[model samples]
Target: MGRKRTIKRDTVLDAAEQVVMRDGAARLTLDAVACEAGISKASVLYDYKTKQALIKAVVERRLAAHATCEQEVAASFSGDPDAAIRTRIEVASHLLTEEDRAVALGLLASLAQDADLREPIARTYGERIAQVTGHSRSPRGALLAFLAIEGLMSLEWLGLHDWAPEERARIIAEIGWLVDQVPAPVSAPASVLSSSPERSTR
Candidate 1:
């Protein structure tokens, strides 16, 4: 008997991603994936029972990559409360490329058809929101920085704005400044302090 060839799961996922990028998610089919992967339909199906399962796998892969990026960035600023959220903005500002923007577009298209496909992504965002808000005393400032980063990414993704590298860097730097703008500490009124219960006892 001949030995059976084993196809790597990543290979299948890569093929599927390419399919989505090229033809949109609606065009993703087992036969198309197999053709893209240069494998038999049965081979692809062996790995993913249905199209939905394969798409979910793709989403999961992206989520794993995102988590790793967050961890790596967070590690750089160990013990710094603001580092957790700030580093995420820093990393995205530096690392997001044109190819990543295209992949994001494809993911959005897929999500439009399968709203349920977003559960994992939603969970990730929820956790990230908590981490960001909890890590910074100035939660509103941190959130503003986060939103600014998202706006820049959207501009890039949409191809509506052509920002020079220097301009983009400057904008991101300004956002970091905004994030660090903690409110001035307020002192208790002198009258209230004099009338304190502890002071009354004295």
Candidate 2:
């Protein structure tokens, strides 16, 4: 019974995504979703009480999936201090798809009208920034790389820029090179270390 309910909920969400993609976010009525899913309006309401609730659910679902992907990628680079930023770069550059961008456009439309809908995004970005900078060899470099990647992704997502595959690859390669150039922290000289007040006192 639990499994059936889960499947039905996913079906509803899928139909809702399609409605947003095919029509505009403005056209995403519960009736439209039900019609698209071939389910009853009551069934849609049972899952999502309002349009705002439904949009939030859709955004949350996507964000959850992205978080899972980040975890998996971070795990693969387990011991690396730069794992968080690197994982973000890998996903933004390679993993995301055109359909994902389209869905993002739909969600952005909804988000622009509702400040409440921005909460999840704000929280996710906050967590991601903390992760990316917390143990970085060079936090500034990591942040710069992160910002650049986000800019690239935003341009693509908003249809502001259409980069050729090769061009995009070249840009990502440059970002990677920049990350690699962030020098490791230099250890203090032996004489300087020996002169430290704490060490000398000890």
Strongest candidate by TM-score: 2
- What clash pairs does model 1 have? none
lDDT of 1 by residue, 13-88 (tens): 9999898878878888999999999999988988799998998899899889878887888888888888866887
TM-score of model number 2: 0.83
Model 2 ranges off by over 4 Å: 1-7, 180-202
Q: What does the lDDT come to for candidate 2?
A: 0.84
lDDT of each: 0.82, 0.84
Q: Which residue ranges in model 1 land beyond 4 Å of their true spot? A: 1-5, 182-202
Q: For candidate 1, give the lDDT of residue 81.
A: 80
lDDT of 1 at 54: 91
